[model samples]
Target: MSDFFNNKRVWITGASSGIGEALAHAFASQGAHLVLSARNEDALGKVAVKCKELGAGMVSVLRLDLSDHDSIPGIVRNMIASVGKVDILINNGGISQRSLALNTSLDVDKKLMEVNYFGTLAVTKAVLPGMITHQLGHIVTVTSLTGKFGTPYRSAYAASKHALHGFFDSLRAELGDTRIKITLVCPGFIRTNVSINALTGSGDKLGTMDEATDKGMSPERLAYKILAAIERGDEEVYIGGKEVLGVYLKRFFPGYFSRLIRKARVR
Candidate 1:
């Protein structure tokens, strides 16, 4: 029950399941107006119903496919018209990778960048105008531990997440002292379908869950942490267990970090 989110219009992509779905419920409980989006319209509708049940101010289901860049602008326009305006945007829609770089096809790499990098960029640009017009907004991106440091099986996925960090960091510098805030959430393994949905070298789903991922933090717990960071206007926040230390380890002890990462069971 956060007063800050009361009646606030919050738009979340990939809201059909996993972390995105948890975020919707978390925001709803705080009385926020919810705009849920994903490729699966039926799934989004189901999430919308749950949001309404959770005491959301208002809930709207909007179909969104990140891969379809041309349709993003129109969807954003309609979302604003219907939900009034997006006060807070959760950039949570993204794909993951789980294949060695050498085995991975170039096409597979390109698709990873297309959805995770270009698709994210497209949505942010489309929403920026409205946030600017309102003179207030928050952009929360759900990057991963890979964004800070790379792993063996997630070459292109790491690249895409790394690209997000670069873009958002520059955007924050450009904004300077503005009411609009940006927060990059770099989470370690979370209990989600991300592993099963991860892309392989051939561009097919991994279709299996990693052991560490199975024992990782819950989405409900991470959602609350994200909400707290947004309220505080934090530029960046890392949420996870020991794996999060890799970000710092890479920075201060590159050689040691490299050896550890190589031996780590990323999959």
Candidate 2:
């Protein structure tokens, strides 16, 4: 792993905490140069220090808010100015939702799309030109299991993730002749602040963790699987416990899976 990633310039969004932070540690241990971005600059700074201590060749902190799509080009410019060209870009910044389809406000759905789908798309576009010019780069998106199939309480969230899968899958086909590769990582659930930070029907934070999220896999373990998938150039990968089986269930047993999901306890 160290030999594969040593001195590679990697950029990760949502690096302030959770899976993103764990990925920072994982990549740092492999001696990768890292650019960590998130809305919280102070938190990013703390994570940057930890990455340095973990043996990162170089670590830089950049403030990035996925909702602020207008500022993305400038951020990418600054990143290129500082780090030259990124070898890999981990599109990990996004918001989750725990709201019902009918109860959720239209504004909340728009906000979800703005941050989860368009925001990631914006960042990927900004970083793509350089990668195209260099003829080498890996684009990784941290999608969700919901991306594969819609689930309860995540209508908007699942839609946004599903859009990413469409966009990236098409982008990969378009760039098939290029050296650049795209990998979409679908994580079922992880013990993180995601549930607590999930948006509600009123567009406010849920402010509480769900039982499923609280008992999910650790961020560190998921990060390892993600990096391994990137190394292997996998087009798509799923990481989770038994919940990941839902993907296959939906695929091979759509009727049963649909009925099961109807009765499943998502929250």
Candidate 3:
């Protein structure tokens, strides 16, 4: 339990399950005050209870649907009223995609962008004013390694994640002197239900976890590393096993990386 997170007010979206849920528990154990949000109120409540049991100073459950753009302002307001001021905003909410570029319809791509990119932006913007006023805050976004390298069957998902990198990189530069930090977490894979809930070309759920993800790093371990990165105020951190090697390959061996990605069983 680092003193850096003790009593810190942190808000995490997508806290119902997977990485978000893991993060909620990790931060709680570190003595952070948490505001957890997700579309599933029941699941959120379950997470909140666990947070409480983990010794979170305070835990509030806020039901949120990232796809519903119109509800963002109210959600932000409610969170602010309950938590006072958020010292850390973890934008962990978003959907994944499991469709080929040609098979993915415009509607499907739009939905992916709306949730993964725009939804993250919406929440960050809502919290920025307070952070600016205080002259301090940390924005940690949970992006995928696919953001850095495009994969065969996840074009739309990759695009949305790529947009996040662009947006946050620029934002970090813009806020350079404000003492605010933006950390982009590029996770290769974690054992989660992300694949199962990922949207297909026709808006259908994939409903099956990918094998790589099933054998990937544990979400709990990933959460710990993410918190360490936040504590260090790192610009970005990639968490995973051998999958993280792809980042290096893409940077130093573009041709080989490209061919490897093309043959990857991303689905």
| Best candidate (score: lDDT) | 2
Error of 1 at 200 (Å): 0.8
Local error of candidate 3 at residue 130 (angstroms): 0.4
Q: Give the TM-score of candidate 1.
A: 0.98
Candidate 3 residue runs with Cα over 4 Å from true position: none
TM-score to true structure, per model: 0.98, 0.99, 0.98
- Model 2 CA lDDT for position 138: 99
Compose the digit string of candidate 2's lDDT tens values, residues 161-257. Answer: 9999999999999999999999999998899999888999999999998899999999999999898999999999999999999999999999999
- After superposition, the stretches of candidate 1 with alpha carbons farther than 4 Å from their true spots are none
Worst 10 residues of 3 by lDDT: 258-267
Model 1 gets an lDDT of: 0.92
Task: Tell me which of candidates 1 and 2 scores higher on lDDT.
Answer: 2
Higher-TM-score candidate of 1 and 2 = 2
Worst 10-residue stretch by lDDT in candidate 1?
A: 171-180
Q: Model 3: per-residue lDDT, tens digit, 1-267?
A: 458899999999999999999999999999999999889999999999999999999999988888888889888988897678999999999889888889999999999999999999989998999999999899999999988888888999999999999999999999988999999999988999999999999999999999988998999999999999999989988899888899999999999998898789757
Which residue pairs in candidate 2 have backbone atoms (N, alpha carbon, C) closer than 3 angstroms, thus clashing?
none
Candidate 2 differs from the real structure by a C-alpha RMSD in angstroms, to one decimal, of 0.8
Q: Name the 10 consecutive residues with the lowest summed lDDT in model 2.
A: 1-10
